[model samples]
Target: MEKVKVDLVVTGYVFNDKKEFLLIYHNKLNKWLPVGGHMEQNETPDEALLREVSEETGLSVEILGKSEIGMGGNVKTNLATPFHVNVHNVGDHDHCSLFYVCKAKGSGEIKLQEEEVGGFKWVKKEDLNQEFIPKDVRNIALKAFETVE
Candidate 1:
């Protein structure tokens, strides 16, 4: 049996009031995907997600959903819950990804990080069905739209 290496990854489905969600064309993966990346050591999934989104798309987003518990005693803060979670293959390895729903907070202009992202688009729910989008991405995107709208 092949050794399966699973990494912790985080992604966000960032939506706007216009009912559009953001998608990035990843340079390495060569696929349309949400803004996210592998979690760094000693970082929480939520922190990693926010950092990744900022680095990849340059959009300031507020993660949707909230924690019921308040921070106290050792716990500095409570993180938002992910709307969806899944394990998917990324060629040589696999990613156990946490998916969060978010909304743009300000101007929402995207400045792509060319080293990681090839391009970006704010797509409508209907756009998910396009042939260029992988089925998993389409399904998750639709779910994000459903959650937001």
Candidate 2:
């Protein structure tokens, strides 16, 4: 049976100290995009961001923004605020994606998940103007860079 469900996904615009952004060439999608994936059960968005970033690039990152929300009484959990949210179609299903800005913890080699990504690169802000990059991703990436500056 075909699964028709709206999946919650997270994306990160990860920048290094040099202010370059990390992008991955998704083998399945055949496009260059930020690192992210579907949120796992029982995991907060911040936790899922860390997990996805580590799994995809092998680099530890500090997600930028508030990592907690006060919901009145004694309930508090670390949940990074998404810089942007939008829904997009993914073949048979849809993905409601939360986009975040992040910074690499330290300098390190990026190890790609060969099965998922064809390649990866650290792109400068100017390079974001390239035609290959989607307009929305480019816009958000530019905003992320500006926010950190």
Candidate 3:
């Protein structure tokens, strides 16, 4: 079997007017998480995030800006300085995640890709405290919410 190459991935925290965060169920992890994925060849982080969020959640979002959240993409992939990186073992592989905040264009029923995700939901900030997202990502979401409020 071929090892999955570590690379820089971008994620978007798509929040709606109702203050609900968009969460997707990742089939690989069997857990719920924010919308994001690997950057395609020659794609910038911002560009990659926009595409990933739209593909995963079926919603349009505009990325705010690049904020270093002490996050990392992967160990094998060389990441620039000031990114908060932590190692999370995923079976034989590891995930070093970078996150960003984004604003959705409008609210509507999400069209999920069945192969990649089992489902999606709009989670409120209060509900996130007990939700399945990682602490770091949750912190980012909280900060985004606080700023918008």
Candidate 4:
């Protein structure tokens, strides 16, 4: 059997004040996806998602999750638990993605990273069923809405 390469990545479902979630048209994937990207060295999943959200949308986001576990001598910090985790193939490789639910913080504009994304949209529950949206993405997006509700 051939070995498959998998990379760690983070994805965030960023919601605005109006209960709309942000979706960006990924240049490489050529599909609409949540704001996220590959994790950098020594960065936690939450940090990666936060950075990706800011870079993709130019908006500060408050990731929603909690870890009641107490910190110890070896534990520098407790990371927020991801709302969902999945390992999906991306043709040439696979991505072990940690999905975080986040809400937009303060005021900001939706400035997309032109080179990384082709376009972006703020979608509501009704919009998730669009033909262009992948099933997993649609399911996860719906879960995100149910989570905040």
Candidate 5:
């Protein structure tokens, strides 16, 4: 087996009130994928998820799931849990991705990250079969769709 470098990454399956999923055309990967990237050091999965969504889609998102943990007196932090986790190959490396469901905060225009993303779209679940999307991505997207619906 070929040696593979593994890295932790966070992904968000952002859905609007209409239940359409957000997808982006990654320039380097040449495939339509969810909004996500490598996790930065010292950042929790929830933090990374939110950051990636905003950076790639230019939309502030509200992650779905329980955001609060009551450990004791006056200590609380809101953070979402990953709906799914998977390891996928990306060229010479693999990413252990944490997937979370999310919703857009407002009606904001998408601003693609020109360097990494080539295009973006809010697609219906049925549209996952489009040629531009990879099989694995489509599977993950389908699950995310079912999750929110």
Candidate 6:
């Protein structure tokens, strides 16, 4: 059997003044992943990233700067990211992830898309090692957390 391909995914490294990272509980796979989703038609990778972040965390995020647009705009390959593959979650498919260093105005009320994402949390970087996020995602979060200050 052939492995399924996610194709593309967008992620946001949401940071708070306390230097905590925002993670969401994805209902699709029942795993904690970055706040992101599949790219919709005619939407740019950045647009998709921002949309997903808002939909998941209800936080308005800004794209700090430019990043490489991957093939078909399926993935956003940012140089600022710590990973080699543009997509953080690989082994699933050839994907490019758009990573943004964003700040939430405050810990406002979050409106999670219950069907897509069940819950969200602002967790400290150190706490992740003891938590259960994907290895690749945890590494990416750690790198982003270090520079969020």
lDDT of 5 by residue, 12-119 (tens): 888988889888888988888889998999898888888888788789998888656666677656567788998988877899988998888988578777999988
What stretches of model 3 exceed 4 Å from their correct place? 1-5, 66-87, 131-136
User: Which lDDT values do the candidates have, in the order given?
Assistant: 0.88, 0.88, 0.72, 0.89, 0.85, 0.70
Please list the Cα RMSD from the true structure of every candidate, rounded to 1 decimal place.
1.4, 2.6, 7.2, 1.2, 2.2, 5.8
Best by TM-score: 4
Ranking by lDDT: 4, 2, 1, 5, 3, 6
Write one digit per residue (lDDT tens) for candidate 6, span 42-148. 87777787788887777876555455655456544453342224743445566666666666765556788787888887788778875577787777777677566
Clash number by candidate, in order: 0, 0, 4, 0, 1, 1
Candidate 4, 1-149: lDDT as tens digits: 99899999999998988899988999988998999999999888888988888888889988888688888788887787888899999999999999988999988588888999899888889888898888899999988898787
Better structure of 2 and 5 per TM-score: 2
Q: Once model 5 is optimally superposed onto the true structure by TM-score, how far is the C-alpha of residue 110 displaced, in angstroms?
A: 0.8
Task: Give TM per candidate.
Answer: 0.93, 0.90, 0.74, 0.94, 0.89, 0.74
Per-residue lDDT tens digits of candidate 1, residues 62-146? 9888798767889878888998999988888999999999998888888999999999888888777888888888888887887
Error of 1 at 101 (Å): 0.6
Q: Could you tell which candidate, 2 or 4, scores higher by TM-score?
A: 4
After superposing candidate 1 on the true structure, give the runs of residues whose Cα lies further than 4 Å from its correct spot. Answer: 71-74
Lowest lDDT sum, 10 consecutive residues, model 1, at: 125-134
Which sequence of candidate numbers ranks them by TM-score, best first?
A: 4, 1, 2, 5, 3, 6
- Can you give the lDDT of residue 39 in candidate 5? 90
Cα shift from native, residue 76, model 2 (Å): 3.1
